[model samples]
Target: MTAARPGSREPGDQEQPGGGAGAAGAPRVPAPRGGRAPGPAAPGPGTVPAVRRGTAPRQRTGRERTGGRPGAAPGPEGDGRLTHQELMSLLGVWALDACSVQEAACVEAHLNDCARCADEALRLRDAVTLLGPPRSLDLDPQLRHGVLESALARRPAVRPVPGWAAPYDAEAARLDALLHDINADEWDIPVRVRWFAGEERAGRSLTVAQVLDHLVAMDGLLARAVGLPDPLGADAPADPLERTETRWRLVTAAGGDSGPARLVAARAWEEWREQSRELVRTAARRGGRTGEEMLPVSVCDPGIFPGLGAAAGPRIPLSDAYLNRAFACWTHAGDIADAVDYPYEAPLGAHLRLLVDLTARRLPGSIAGRRRAGLATTRARLTTAGAPGRTVHLEIEGAGGGDYWIPLDSPTAAVTRVAARDAVAQVALADVEFCRLAAGRQSPAEAAVAGQGDQAAISDVLSALTALSRL
Candidate 1:
């Protein structure tokens, strides 16, 4: 559960994977359209779906006129600061260009000062825009332009932060986009975890809200472990699983079978998500290294850190903790997708590569812990097949494709890219399937794997992957 910081190595450490930035495949948003993103456009035909997968919507639109009353009073009873409820109400009105001149000015002014509100407004606008314009009425182009211009005027250009953890940020963004427009009723649909962990017959289940609550609970553990604030706050339980269960129960209770309560739960999930994103951002600022760093946490649950008592959990690398969070997020995203009946697949790009690399880097330690003799003497070259450009490379095609080499017992065991031309064992599968296997969501028997040379070595590697997760 501990890890070396990005670009750092401990004794007997190998080169780090993802040491080099891969293809810049993630879409390039205009650089703030002269330091501000253009105002969001209405969703084109077939744009607005109730809920979509984790793909981020394009925020680009053609240039438009900027027109809105400036320095106007918000409303009859308004002070400068708009309450949360008021701001929420105005978001849709503003997006649809239905706001009065004073109201539009007030919203724009508020957005200029509040980044969070600005983000929400943009998202809301995108949702409305996705619904597309009504075919019944030929709306004036100037009206739409005015709304977009006002919205754009207040938007400051945002630059992506560069760090080793950027991949994690990208993954988090996709999950957030997926959760944005879900209907309140969908939150109560029970999710079956049968496909994962072979517990189908156990009848284990969680509703959409419960799944999110579980995520917040689990994320809080890693956050506290690495000195980040616990999203669940000070009054939560001391045990990790107990705290998660307790929180889930409270979330369900707070969701008092009322429509508003479910909406509140959804908002709460968004808050938890922001906290999780903040952790990634903070870590990136620290050069993306957080292993074995000591930090005080109110609850030190032994369940979160196996083999470590409460007192011993403080001194832990946050990177390891973050990886743990990433794994949980990736695995549970699949669960959420299943709950909603959406086709789910993890990207084979940076985030998955990091997960694979982390597992590969820890293979030695895993073997040593589970089978002591196996670690002391086992020396094998592990490579991946099925990727183009490299003869012995791991390939994950589709959205986030990349070629990687798994260094089993090499001096540079941590390196993500492969330098070795030949490996004693090469196993190839799609990245999503590989992730499932590594996460223990799929047993080796269930995984479709092609292996060549050193069948015994292949078994060892697969065994290590199957047992990699402590959760």
Candidate 2:
């Protein structure tokens, strides 16, 4: 939080200010030297430092005068020619630091005279105050261990699937192979065996089989939202009615050991899985005919509903759907696999790339809002795997606008192989910290790893993901 010295080399160009820079014509005084007492010195030409009566005098920067008169000439580096915005940013940074009340009062007085800076200062103050102090929470040691251990144990195995291939074909092939290895009559057997000997029997409240079913159901809801045909069959009842019936059946089937709500959720998931499979089939067929067509629907759009309503016109496109489904399935599959002791594979390169692109493109608005509010600076750095030794820089412009990208790389070329859909998946799965924040289970700062701090940056990323869900 040290103030930049006049004529001093600027910190790294990447450095962003918490508040705006100093106003034009303001002198850039050297920050106080370490614990040294002020000595008598005549006021230097063009200097204007604050002075106290009856005390050993310190030189003043001409800009320190309170007469509302113009100050002396700016330094050789144009020390005082900062825009109102820059001044606000600087003030914000200073306020966040440990400064004397008197010093803050000086800045406040200047801000009142400069209308533009005044508004920005207010916004910055609000953001800083709203973000508040970081909270401290004691986590259950066993739960913490379980969370980390699960992630570590299920490290994704990255096998490169062809970037040009359709994900549904690959998934179907895998499913077919799996089914071929087991009798059709035993399709229900895995569920039964899992029920008897799975995590549920080991004292966990939910079983691996239950988790799988739940994910399957959630996928169905996604498909329906996207306007795809129902997978359970065209005649399948509407989701609400079907869910109600499913719950009743589960309660009766389990002899009341399982609650009605839990059963309903499980049945809903079964339907969801069936729908997802059907969507895959449709996607594969379309690909066979057209090489690859974009699906004209988007599940992420806020307009889409669980059932009854058609997905809004102009779908998100088929290729995008492939990426999205792959990401969704892959991540959730990993979750189930971890719970059930199965191998989990990461998505292909194209899928991962798409995810990165989406994340970069959509998160700036949220960041901008936070920055304007003075919650944090607009500048943020993102570090990811594969793209090692490079950082993605994000700069927020306004409440919901800005630019983000890696330096020295073309956005189109860098993200050509990436899928927007997959980006959502990665955020949902691999970035569990973000997911927890999005789920409201933790705050942004608390989720950040120590020494790798940047809660504002992480929050921006989470905000983008949340936006997608709204979309």
Candidate 3:
């Protein structure tokens, strides 16, 4: 007879003289180490005593054990064997090498016998191949620098962000990154948005997801102007205040206005990202054209703040509107940062300068608007942009900043550069602080660091800056 191979069992190795045989002539086999027994088939639990012969089992937690037993199959209760559903659920962990040794043995044995499980196991193992290997959390420090350098290289005629739209693009991208990184639970965290409305400190409370809902409604206006669909449907109110309310109501009805509003946030987030991308693409199509149109989109209504005329708000250029969108994005991003206790930097120098310039240019209108509502000292001394007029030497200090002699009376007046000494008063401010003031995040009382000249003009200009802020 041919010699039995190494580790092979002899005929009747696991068979007792009495019974316990599997199939015709083949023994119910698992010849255990150094055993000599002729005993009855086990009838109950522990009757077939647990024999652990391998290395000591690792410290076990829930549903964990070491090696599988030899010859000891499950009793009537199928004790120690996992359910089909349980085994299926373990496929991922098993693929990842996370399953305990006993569980691995169980999974392997079951996969061989059950075609369905075997198919799933094959697929899972194939997927695990794509996982490669475990990696360390520590990343190369220059990875971000390399990636950004790659993405920022200007591909002319392709995704070219116009100079005016860069701030909006950057801020939108920053906010999108923040949203992508946050967990579902963070969506429910409360955020309070403050702005100067009706000539007073006005504020409202909303969850983070609700905040995104608000953003979608507001940004949808720019989307509409650019011929993109609004997140809040076509019939949505043109007025921002009403639009915001309408958005919140819809979110509430959808069962996403409250605790852990992950669905709402996710929907709004998708819309925001898509809309932002579309906007950038549309701007790219403009090819440096200002697309200057009378966008009556009231970011801050002349009626909202008291003294402004019954006349509609500024007929801001579309380029200016893009800048406004960027400003709002940056401001709200800061709100999100506060909610999550994250630190975020302000816009870059060029972008910040443009933002500040826009806000400064609009200040004259805000002051005039506030005056009509009796908020500022009405100055009838109209200054012409062509000829010399009452100009504040608005010294914006820091990057993206330049000296601006903004006319106090009218938005139409030409801003002729005047000698520094010829200025009525010089209001010097850190560039970012001025932006915060315009965003209504800071009060006029604390917004200015040093003001020398007409305190009244300074106060009026400062207060009017906040008037630029809206819901």
* Strongest candidate by TM-score: 3
Cα lDDT of model 1 by residue, 1-471, tens digit: 222223422211211111112234311111011121233343223211121222233342312223322434333354434465776677676665556545555555555445466566657655764575333222232343356458757883243333344545555655665576456566676776533222221235766656677777777766665567776776666666687778766765876335653675576577668877887767756652443355443333332332233324434345545655666676776777667765555543555666655554454444434343344224443543322121223443433334445434432234323433555556677667767765666777887887786676567666655655433
Clashing pairs in 3: 306-373, 307-372, 307-373, 308-369, 385-413, 385-414
Summed backbone clashes in each candidate are 14, 36, 6
What TM-score, computed on C-alpha atoms, does each candidate reach? 0.51, 0.34, 0.64
- lDDT per model, in order? 0.51, 0.37, 0.64
Assess the local accuracy of residue 333 in candidate 2 as a C-alpha lDDT between 0 and 100.
Answer: 42
Cα lDDT of candidate 3 equals: 0.64
Tell me which of candidates 1 and 2 scores higher on lDDT. Answer: 1
Model 1 misplaced regions, further than 4 Å: 1-162, 194-203, 232-240, 252-267, 284-316, 372-424, 469-471
Regions more than 4 Å wrong, model 2: 1-165, 168-206, 221-228, 231-277, 288-315, 358-459, 462-471
Which of the predicted structures, 1 or 2, would earn the higher TM-score when compared with the native? 1
Residues forming the 10-long window of minimal summed lDDT in candidate 3: 1-10
lDDT of 2 by residue, 1-471 (tens): 011112221001121222234667443332322122355454333332232222332333223322221332222245434344544545655334333333444454455356455555444533544454443222222343355448756883132222323444344333333323433233232221111111012112343334344344434444664467533334544343253345345544766434444354445444545655666655444443332444434333222211111322344434444554444444444344344334434333333344333334334333333344454433533434223221233332222223233221111123211321122111122344433232233343455522222344344444433433210
lDDT of 1 at 445: 80
Stretch of 10 with least lDDT, candidate 1: 27-36
